[model samples]
Target: LDVPCKVVITAPEGEDPHPRFGKVEMSHAKHRNVSCVSCHHMFDGCGDFQKCADCHIDRDDRSYERGFYKAWHSESEISCRGCHKAMKAKNEQTGPIGCLQGCHEAAQK
Candidate 1:
């Protein structure tokens, strides 16, 4: 008789070098609906996500910048989805470009 053993694999805290950073407690229950493939692509995955273009606008080859992550999280250690979730709840609005309806809404607030 042969027995089968199952191994449980857990992802490291945070994606890569950007591990939590000791700012806030990580939320395990949140982000249950989001999938790893939702944010990642063939080349880069969710771990490589950046916020530079998120708040910037490009016009005629010129890009203007607005608030940055530093201002948004205020030096917290929450994940991207965690932050967005709160902003959406606070705003109580939803749409394509709006905050509360997408992955950003689920990020750290």
Candidate 2:
């Protein structure tokens, strides 16, 4: 609900922390000045949480044009690199951020 908030995702006391998905903590550092509605665009008072892949499907099999990739890295206003670059220009110290070198670590494998 606010910047720098810690959203703890927990499971039952004895159960595995990740019965299905692992623990998730939504950080606000990257999006400190951004509003929740910017990313959760479908939220209108109340709505279900939809995964990025739900709408950003790999239709043409092109990594650059893929919905999920484009959604966060293309010409969109909220692109990660775009914002980081801007921050860097402002001397905000967004050190060495890039698609391959930063966010998507699994892609390296």
Candidate 3:
């Protein structure tokens, strides 16, 4: 199967589509070396890829473990922010970890 070359990532519009910043274009090429399971952890190596919003939601009854915000910004290393932080810790090439620097920026390289 062909992975997406780029993806415009935004908050999954769960039943209550909470407020969020602008969509961020993610280049899969930028993460070519990373395993797909690293981000698509929910996938079972079969069937279609499940959208992140499929489980992580913004419902009022959601737990921190399943919250959409936690899915992106959690301390877990698989998250976009978490991965970036890990790379930066090792002085490896990585994206920004701030609001106005990467995800919320007008554009990324």
lDDT of 1 by residue, 5-107 (tens): 3211122344332233213222323434545333221215334434333432232232222333332232222324334555466794422333333324433
Clashes of 3: 0
Query: What's the distance in Å from true for residue 80, model 1?
Result: 1.3
For residues 5-86, could you state the per-residue lDDT of candidate 2 as single tens digits? 5443333345554233344344566556677676656657565656555666553444665454465556444555565667
- Sorted by TM-score (best first), the order is 3, 2, 1
Each prediction's RMSD to truth: 13.2, 7.8, 3.3
Best model number under lDDT: 3
TM-score of 2: 0.51
Compare candidates 1 and 2 on TM-score and give the better one.
Answer: 2
Off by over 4 Å in 2: 1-33, 59-66, 106-109
Candidate 3 lDDT over 8-78, as tens digits, reads: 76755534323445677789898889999999998888988877777776645434867777777776888
TM-score, per-candidate, Cα-based: 0.22, 0.51, 0.81
Best candidate, TM-score: 3
| Model 2 lDDT on a 0 to 1 scale | 0.53
